[model samples]
Target: LHPAQDIPNARGTALIAKVKKPYTEDPASPVRERQSVGIYADWLPAPASFGDYDQFEGIARIPGQISWRFTMHQVQEDAPSWFGGSPWTGKFDEISSELTVNTLVEVRPFNSKTKKAGQAVLQGTLQRCRG
Candidate 1:
């Protein structure tokens, strides 16, 4: 996107802060190709600078493909300010929705244990990764 061009939906490409979780397993059946598991936060934008994250690694890009990617903190609480600005702090422990529509998202830090959806926020940010 051109710098001068207006940001789509008043923002950049949406961001998803996904920390790959352990593969789902089933003891009753034989082991098979495990499905990907994750704990994530959606719509958090990339910081304007790399210095924003708690840790830093080099950013790279494939010549043609979408090579840009950033590793997130294994513990979300330790993440940088860019995770979801300040509003989203302490709200993410588990996310259980596909989030196809732009609307409030329920964040349940204890959902894994309680099996419930907690309070909803405007998903912190609907647009993401502008930087």
Candidate 2:
């Protein structure tokens, strides 16, 4: 077995990306708009910067004999125009004014030493949202 096998098996790595939940609130909004979420994985460095709509693009890695790459993005919004003036709305407006991020995830394997000892990486860009 290689690091790739050990990382997820014996070593065991877990990652969680969290954002403030208040940014997705609106009391009278009925439409569900996109929310940007900032994703931070384990053992990886902070992203240099995100692009338009808080779109973050690059390689996210696990950093081992067999590595994986990933890309992420995020955003936030109060409520869409379509949700303007509605009775069946929740308190999504009272939510904090923060960017709601939408992160896209993708994965692929990379083999260096041998085909059997291949690695996997996740990559993608974040979608934009209005706050």
Best by lDDT: 1
* CA shift of 128, model 2, Å: 32
Predicted model with the maximum TM-score:
1
**Alpha carbon lDDT at 115, candidate 1:** 34
lDDT of 1 by residue, 57-129 (tens): 1112223332222333323455555435321222232334333223222222222233332222212322333
Query: What would the TM-scores of all predictions be?
Result: 0.21, 0.19
Misplaced by over 4 Å in model 2 are 1-54, 58-64, 79-131
lDDT of 1 at 100: 28
